[model samples]
Target: MPSKLTTVLAVGGVAVITSNPGSGMHALVQEHQMGILIEAENQQALNDGIAAAMSQDTTQFSQNARRYAEQHLSLEGVMRGYEQLLLTC
Candidate 1:
């Protein structure tokens, strides 16, 4: 199942602000230029990330996020992945 954040990205055009604690979420956000990522458990970093996300024009980020979601997280995309997996099996 897709995470809530992934679902949001798949359905909405919005920027994400999230913490990175060595999870792959940071990589995804960075690779897609989707939003602001901050060090986990750091109040100051979180605050700064939020500030940056709010201050910048996030249109490109939103577009990138949506594009990534469409390519990787959409229902059709997931089905294609599953089909390929079944074929391999």
Candidate 2:
């Protein structure tokens, strides 16, 4: 068994893992702000999984998350009732 840590990305909606602070983790975190799941089975497996994710097309994942956020958490929609705050000096 191996130790692990799971991180949740609030904005990107991506989950990634690594056994150490390496390129596999670096790429995902840098490109997509992917949440980190750490210390998986071994360094190799963790690296491979992240690498596989990199190879696959993530268009559907991105689109779904974006659509959901836009509909339920749009900035404009969230601030609609705070117009007076912006006007105040």
Candidate 3:
């Protein structure tokens, strides 16, 4: 995820994450704790995806999202992961 999305998730905001097919979104969906994925190939599809995300459930994931982001997705966590990978050497 980009910094913008990272900030949103870090602040307990549900994101409507969208990207073109094979261009993005899946890694984020798989890794992030909170957000909806919108995979679109065209303009109309992208619009629909945004609408769908806007209308979906936020209450279900808002509380845990920030904590999850900090513990698993934050810069500190990334540094830890990098350190751990180096330790395998």
Using TM-score as the measure, the top candidate is: 1
lDDT tens string, model 2, 1-89?
Answer: 11122212325344554535565655544444334445655876778667856887765555544553454346774575366567784
Ranking by TM-score: 1, 3, 2
How displaced is residue 86 in candidate 3, in Å?
Answer: 1.7
How accurate locally is residue 12 in candidate 3, as Cα lDDT from 0 to 100? 88
Candidate 3 total steric clashes: 0
Q: What are the clashing pairs of model 1?
A: none
Question: Can you write out model 3's per-residue Cα lDDT over 1-89, one digit (the tens) per residue?
Answer: 58897788788887766664465466645454466666655667678767866787667556556877787688898899889999998
Error of 1 at 3 (Å): 3.3
Location of the lowest summed lDDT over 10 successive residues in candidate 3: 24-33
In order, candidate lDDTs are 0.75, 0.50, 0.70
Q: After superposition, how far is residue 53 of candidate 2 from its true place, in Å?
A: 2.4
Alpha-carbon error at 15 in model 1, in Å?
A: 3.9
TM-score of each: 0.78, 0.34, 0.64
- Residue 58, candidate 1: alpha-carbon lDDT: 78
What's the lDDT for residue 85 in model 2? 66
Query: What does the lDDT read for residue 49 in candidate 3?
Result: 61
